[model samples]
Target chain A: MNWFLKGTLTATLLTMGGVGAMAAPGVTEDKIVLGAVDPLTGPPSLLGKAHSLALKVWQEDVNARGGINGRKVEIVFEDDGYVPARSLQSLKKMVEVDDIFALIGTSGSSQLAAMMPLIDELGIPALNNMAVNSHHFNPPLETLFVVGPTYCQELAAGMTYLVEELGLKDEKYAIAFQDDEFGDDVRCGYLAGVEKYGLDNVLELEFKRGQKDFSAEMLKARAAGVTVLVSGGVVAEHSTLLKEAAKNRMDITFLGAHSAHLTPVQALAGSAGDGYYAADYVPALTSLQVPGVARFMDLANKYLSESEMDSLNRYALSGYAGAMIFEHVMTECGEDLTRACVIEKMEGLDGFETDGLLGPVTYGEGVRHAPTGIMVLQSNAEDKTFSIVSERMEVE
Target chain B: MDYFILLTVSGIAIGVIYGLIGMGYALIFKATSVVNFAHGEIMMLISYMAFSIASSWTLPFWGLLLVCVFISAIVGLVIERVFIRPMLGQDVFSTVMVTIGLAVMIRAVVVLIWGADPLLLPTDIGDSGVEFGMVFLYTSQLYAIGLLAFCVLGMWVFLRFSRMGVAMRATAARETTALLMGINVTHVYAIAWAIAAVIAGISGVLLGTIYGLGPDLWTQGLRAFPAVILGGLDSVFGAAISGILIGVLENLSEGYIGQGLKEISGFLVILVVLMIRPYGLFGTPEIERV
Candidate 1:
């Protein structure tokens, strides 16, 4: 070979080796920095604040334990204010400026949908426990790991329990849902249950997203002789639906998704809020009997203020669980942490337990969605709390 | 048949609340020639004020309603003096923009104070309400309908006979002429704002009781806008009747169609009405819209 050709080969090999050995961004020998995008301001801050607080508790606890595998975990949060456009902006800032190794919180459903393209392009490991949509993992991004069941899966499991276990197989069912993507996911589950059990579905009602009144919807439900109702409402809609049904003096069994598992639902529905069901993957905050919940409560009490403790909800439990999963993957990666290593460890999560805080997380090979099993919870209006009413149920 | 009766009654109940909000909008426009874009936020602020009052001190519904009237009156007067009063001689468009800015501020302040969680107004009436045959209405809802009637009658009587009412009508007609005729045009504007604030307070407290109070409760103001435009923006009585008409139409459409049509049903009717009348159902071409 010519002298110039030999030197060119040596230089090219050195450049390839240097590119291969470069350390991951947002990671140092003594620290691992992650990013969180949430609706930290505005009205939806209720969810974001609680999630951020729980993650704070996790961070303090991890560092107090001499750090996870000898690297202190640091998280930088950007408020998306529950807007889709703001979510993409927040994610971009976190990637370019914060240089985050992973994302721990992905705002609301539609908000996260806005950030997916960038998430894929950046190949950043994202642990999503706040909002789980089917589209989030159907095509499957390489580094995004979802830690909970989609609204479809939760509602379907809830319907199954209502039909098979609750002995309402012959009862007529109906659904009052919104007219958007989350609502469509809910309808998918309700229809799935109808098709699987051959149950009679009398009416399928759709309403606007922020609609408050349901008098007409309830009257139509009454006209259809609906005995079982599935609600696809987000927050106040569930309470308002219950209130409207009570006003119409309808004897109906209502079931909803995880969003219904909130104290304000009972508070707004007054006495009419009693005895409704919510399907969720995480145990309720009031479920102190669970070992994981007990541990989380202890840490939260030890770390959070009185008002912050009061703000703890199902979202907090899920956030802590996400932190646990992230810590597990990070530890498994040992001192040689990288985005690809975390992705591999997360994908191989098989029945990893959160001690009853969440259902067993089992993301089989090539699957990004770790659909932990869903459980049914019944509301008690008097106390404004929920108790587990059904065993863990899996979505098919 | 029973279902229709129930839906109609419910629609009218909700419509009465909207009419109350629309009355505020109509009252401000009749007196100031500028739409108070912050009218719904005015209701929300007062309702949250009532919530705070009730939560802090255990007061009966009547007692709470009375306190809210006083507080809302002060709020309206202050808002008129501080915000709207400054833009008095400016173009109507600038005054409307000021109201819009006031609206954004009031909404943000409400969320900041009350937080974003939905709250139930504590009440002695409870949720079962009064049931007449197949129809059921909350005590607050029944009060909502009664209050609308009382407001319309009181407004009609006051505007027809009272000296202040004559002054208000003159000011609404021509501020410069009213000023020249020693009518105290600014005082008329203040009185108009105060009365509108009282009506909004009543509606706010009642609606909060029925629907459960939240930060976005101000959106109901926008919902009542069609009532204002559909009835004649300058005609308070027309706004009330149009509110009822729109509410009933929304409920009936939702009942019959069942595909989220209720949200746009009122707007659709308003579109048809505007296309036909050009200046709303009751608005006059040159003057005397009231």
Candidate 2:
């Protein structure tokens, strides 16, 4: 009985030592675990699924290459279902239960906002590429690293190109936007373009989100003689607007934010999506001309199944780019990777390139968001693909 | 003038869809005195079913519509039996709550099967619009208007002349009394649901063709609610007319006022109309003695 008691004590001490040697939270000698919260079950699952697939591909690639500092990386995903409260709860669960070292795949603007307090409290090094809302960075959190420009900046840049470079300055401009923060951001860009180009701002309209019918809005645009329309709709609304314009026989040039750079938009809009300009921060899915996109497609085909491959869109590229940036930061931190170390390295990142997937990412002290350059893309309705139509326009 | 004409035409097109769905709501409520909160989900589910069938087979528009209507009727019957029939003796609120739960479940099941991505529904009618001088109309829009008219006319004829329709009306007026008079109230309830589902299915498919099919398509049912209230909750024909009136009013409001008033215009009308006539334009006023 004495020998058994002594042995049990020794075993317990050894277990304590083993647990202590695991280094950081969610970090073991052989593995580093990360958390992702996204709308995985609702209408926004398209974005979340693509994001997860990209992360999965990146994880596979990193593990194959011995991971960061010889530790395999893993991601645990929680579905927020696009609800802000759910996003907060999912983040809480991931932090408390999963013990994630870093966070990625923060959902929409409101969702990310909901998780911000928890992220700050936990000191989680988070990379947000999905939503680059300005509020998230106005008083930047020390550990939050934002990639990509805000919709305002993106659309503004795209409009600049349309007016100055594409020679749409003479056309009557109109804005049909959703009445929300996202729409307001897009409208800011539209207003900027109108002011800079001294163009005719014929009409500015707002519609409710998830509105199916846009016939009245299109008719209103037609009445205003809008020759160049800036569509501030996200995914489905963009297609609906185009369809309405087509039905109205309104000969107009349409422009959209980064969300328009999707295969689904082109597919849904059918012939109406032809020649529509979409401003994007990342190279398009079909922009295989870029080395980064070519490599991504190769990796995607290799790692993802046939259906998963079909699901690849701009979101996938952005997610992969984000994962690549995280990997860079982690690689730079070497074997001494703590959440603080990752954040420190991320803040010091300069001209980090995704091999042309995105503009050179540069972040420094006091800067949370790296205003990456924007590219304008045009959809070919026949093939349901978008091709880069302009050089990357650097936004200040 | 062209803009007005365009707005009016477009409003009528959307209004017809709203009316069709509203009619479904009215029919069910009239027969069972219990609102199927799943009316929108039924519409969305049927549309998705139609989408799946359309994707897998090469069927003309008419053939696809027929198939969807038939399938929707069976779904309605099943829903009535499995969910509604069991709760016949329960409180009306409980039955309504069940339908609300069923709505969420149907939405989940749809997302599970088709995923969250919105898909373009292929149809026989192409994207080209008919040019009526200054006014333009999509082929789908024209079809929607025609279908709404056809359904409303058929419903009117059925209720006025058919045996089952009269039985349903009797059952709706007084369930126990209808039962005493040798009418099977359960059968009438099932038939009402089936017909309502068929109407909703037709509207859903039309809306799908016009707007594309997505999980959020169920919200269209909610949008048609104002139509139902304005037309009288239990008056199918009144709901049909109110749906169009609300649609036109919404469009005109958006066209002129233009500050996102289109969505609220219908509800505003409902409020004003209800304030003046609580029973709606065509609804039967109920009387009680305490």
Report the lDDT of model 2 for residue B79: 92
Return the TM-score for candidate 1, rounded to 2 decimals. 0.95
Query: Which digits, one per residue and each the tens of the lDDT, describe model 1 over residues A298-342?
Result: 999999999889788889999999999999999999998989899
| Per-residue C-alpha lDDT of model 2 across residues B95-162, encoded as one tens digit per residue | 99999999999999999999999898888875866888877788888888999999999999998899
What pairs collide in candidate 1? none
Weakest 10 consecutive residues of candidate 1 chain A by summed lDDT? A1-10
> TM-scores for chain B, in order?
0.96, 0.98
How would you class the docking of model 1?
A: medium
- Superposition TM-score, candidate 2 onto the true structure: 0.96
DockQ of each: 0.71, 0.84
- Which regions in candidate 2 have their CA more than 4 angstroms from the true location? A1-22
Model 2 local distance difference test score: 0.90
